[model samples]
Target: MKNPCIRVLATGGTIAGKAGSATRHDYRPGQIGIDDLLSEAESLGMAVTLSGVQIANIGSEDIGPAVWSPLHAATVAAVADPAVDGVIITHGTDTVEETALLLDLTLPTAKPVVMVGAMRPADAVGSDGLRNLANAVRVASDPGAAGRGVLVVMGDRVFAARDVRKVRTRGTDAFRGFPRESIGLVTPSALDWFGAPWRMGEAARFVWPDQWPEVPVLPIWAGIEPDYVTRLTGPDTRGVVVAGVGEGNMPEPVRQVLRELAVRGVAVVRASRIDEGLVDREPEDDANGFLAARALNPPKARILLQLMLASGVSVRAAMQAEFDRR
Candidate 1:
């Protein structure tokens, strides 16, 4: 390998997807090991440096701080090493976006962090994992992609980590949201675009707050119980994120609990459940409880909340300011 140290973090996802029977779409995830995946790299004609970390194999719903903590810690550590230039994470599609978003905000380094996944599991007859892996190799090895923060490479298209989202239900290109941010794209006849690289050669740049606060993102669905909110806002809670309805609307019951949380000194931010659009403030409904004027997604808003507390930024003002900085 020419580059010798492009770390490959194998937190299993569909790319490593395997099935109970080859004919079934249902997969046994976390089945493939890192070495097997790496074995394909050599065949792909890649000259990139490589390393692997097995952070988790269960469904991302099963993924939480236990898995995220070590996964994040490993990524932070990898970028600090002079021997390592970039990282490639193979994760399941379900939570890849969330993990990618989390790392986008949490990781302390700027080294390129590219995440990729497959719609079809490794066991599928025409599984897209290998090609996805190959494309990631191309992107990670590209000397131009440093300092761009984390990224997602799949279907031969590159997307910024923060902006990537999945729109398709069952296609190799199921994971959408990347090409929109593409300053350029590598097409079949135009494979030469692959050579352009995604960033400048300098390393990465990631600046985090000196302190990090613990915040919880609790969701509220119609006709749901109230215990969920109270438990999340109980003692030791620093912040609460209600995955409110459209435009930050919430069930009257849930909204009341959220207000109580705010009254108790816990920061409460309102974000919509819808994937698109800013969480609108329902003035007639009394939704001044949100921090969305700062223009943050629920998860990112929660992260900023932690960063705010860590930095001693006033909660209310921090909620508004997070949007300003973003």
Candidate 2:
């Protein structure tokens, strides 16, 4: 059988970072380029033809619509190419989940799209970038990986994009899949599957606007004020996601503000700030005109809301169905 061909899209992150000293704490992200990363991956002797494109050279924290627009277009185009069997994205771990979720929502291909990142700098002792990159290529080449939407490969664990989140700041085991175990695991010999495949709604191509709608995420904390909610009522503010306390609860004052925003046609979504759990609809939430985000974290919920609003879909019904999907 012919070896699968993979196109790697590299975005700057720790995997491409370079520290001045191996024992130093400070390092510069994106100092290394995609060509070098791929060259190292090739040394692993994986049975695949690897190619790379430099999408961006910055940490994930700097990732936004400017990067997302082109990245999405590039990914869609790459997967559509007959020569490319799968796509792999090298991203920074800081916000890798957000990027993965965005791609998962947008990409329509059955071919694999795997996102890989490293917690340590490329030049650091025991750096994991090469191994993670090799594992990502392996997963992408596997036929079983098709139809699984976007998968995040880190520390030998494969997580569905929708369920994966960065849990730690500095560790090889920085990502975790919530509400359940990882869908697959990467071994030295092959990728192993232990869970059923899952995917989001069919890809809906979106035209990149000059500016994406301004949707802000507000966290609920003790003594939180409703002043910020009022600011979100500005014309430029299209939507808001409340990272509320347990079970997606917000203060009464903030709830009132959200009700006001909803009355004015601004979409409001309720998501838990906690790592894992379901946000079911409650009477008060309904009365306040808030949509429950179900199992989605605040950041992911924000992305979904942005896409739904941008596509002219009914936010309430769409979000409810997304959460209720099997």
Candidate 3:
């Protein structure tokens, strides 16, 4: 039988970064290209036949709709290809979770789509990029990796895109699954599973908007001024997500502004700034037409809100149903 073909789409991050010195922290991400990264992976002697496409070579921090639209389309095409068994994405760790979640919600194929990145630069000593790339290939080629939405592989751990978050800024083990344990782990010798497999709806059934709505995440702190909320509200603002403190609670002033925004037809979702927890609506929240983010973090909640608004669904109703499913 022919080896399964894995198409790696590279959207550069620290995994492709280059530093002046091995010990130096300053470096430019995406200095290396997709071909180079794939060569490193190939050196690992994985059984699968690997090919690559360079989607972008910019840091994940710069990622937005312009990049996401094309990336999503390319992913769909790759998964739909008969010869391709799975797909791997090389992304920057900064915003990889957001991109992964976006793909997971829109790309419904059962074929594995594994997202990988490195904490250290590619040229640095003790770089984890090559190993992570190889592990991503292994996961993508595994039949068991299918139907699990999108997965992030880093530091020998496998995280579901929806539940994964970047916890440590500089640690090699930067990514973690929150409000839930990691679904699996990847070792040189074996791939182990520990969580239930889940699937997403068909992409064809959902409409991809020509333009994405502007939804910004606002973090609430103690004694925050109402002007901060006032600045975000306008006709151009389609939705706003508040990264509130402790169970999605915001200052009363901020909450008042959110209610005003809701009255003006702007969708409001309350997500917790805390590392892990559900953000359900409190008594006051219900009266303000606010939607809880459930267990989703601020960034993920922002993505979900954009998607919901794009579909022309009642944002509150859509959000309610999404959390109800959990």
Candidate 4:
């Protein structure tokens, strides 16, 4: 039997690497294109019909809106083809989470969009490209994986694009579930998720935060008193995401300032410092109108807070609910 059709979109990373003296055969992005990745795919025995499509030859860390636009367009277009069963993306681990989140919000596709990256470079002695890429191909072609939304398949865990994170800086299992926890790691680079299964809602769209006020993620760490919170506010700042302690608990002192910011219409959403659990909404009587995020870590809470602020969800309850849905 013929393998399913899976398009491997090479944005370039350790997966498409060649001997680069820059980092000393240290594996770098841009040394090859989709063709090189696809060539390796065949050698790895992934028999899926592969098309080499290159989005960028640069590191995923250095990638942003300038490159994401074209890649997003390509992903949107590729999913429309009946012959294409799925799509795999080779990305840099640094910003893979951001890209995954960007695609989750911007693209409308039921077909699985798998984002794959490697910790060690391809030219290294024990590179993980072959394994990571192979894992991505399995996810991209699985009907069960489609529309679970964009996924980051690495380190033997398949994580929802929005739920995954680079927890270990230099491990093969670089990305995985956070505080919310995952259903399971079916493959080395995949994590299971539960939601409205395998369907891309047509309602998703990108309203850039450029016009919206800036939303900064002000993390409150132990003993580093938050004098910066006072100066963190911007003229156009719409809100802030406080990366607080477990269950969104902030220092007793900082809570006062955060509440004050909320009073001035600067939305403050609380996330957890713990890997598990979420920020409980302010109690009915203690309701300072601060919203709570769904186990969103500091960075992504910023993404959600910024999106809500940008889209003008004025009520704290509504903002909280919006994040829960995401």
TM-score of each model, paired residue for residue: 0.80, 0.95, 0.96, 0.84
Candidate 3 per-residue lDDT, tens place, 250-295, comes to 8887888889888888888888899886887677766899888888
Colliding residue pairs in candidate 2: none
Lowest summed lDDT window (length 10), candidate 3: 198-207
Off by over 4 Å in 3: 200-205
Q: Supply the global lDDT for candidate 1.
A: 0.68
- The better-scoring model by TM-score among 2 and 4 is 2
Query: What digit string (tens of lDDT, one per residue) describes model 2 on residues 165-238?
Result: 98888879988987656899895468899865554334534444455678999888999889977764578888
Best-fitting candidate, measured by TM-score? Answer: 3
Ranking by TM-score: 3, 2, 4, 1
Error of 3 at 246 (Å): 0.9
Over 4 Å off in model 4, which ranges?
A: 1-3, 17-27, 179-213, 284-286
Q: Which candidate is the best by lDDT?
A: 3
Global lDDT of model 3: 0.86
Candidate 2 similarity to native, TM-score? 0.95
| Alpha-carbon RMSD to native, per candidate | 4.2, 1.9, 1.6, 3.6
How well is each residue in 1-326 modelled by candidate 4, as lDDT tens digits?
A: 77789877778766666665534644556677777678877886655788868888887778866887778788877888888888888898888887888787766657888898887777776778878888788778777776677888776667887678777767576666764444335453344545445454453555554553577777777875656787877767788887777777777677777777788888888887676656666673146767778766777777666666667768766777777765
Q: Distance (Å) between predicted and true CA of 233, model 1? A: 3.5
- Candidate models: Cα lDDT each: 0.68, 0.85, 0.86, 0.73
User: On a 0 to 100 scale, what is the lDDT of residue 141 in model 4?
Assistant: 75
How many residue pairs clash in each candidate at the backbone level? 11, 0, 0, 14
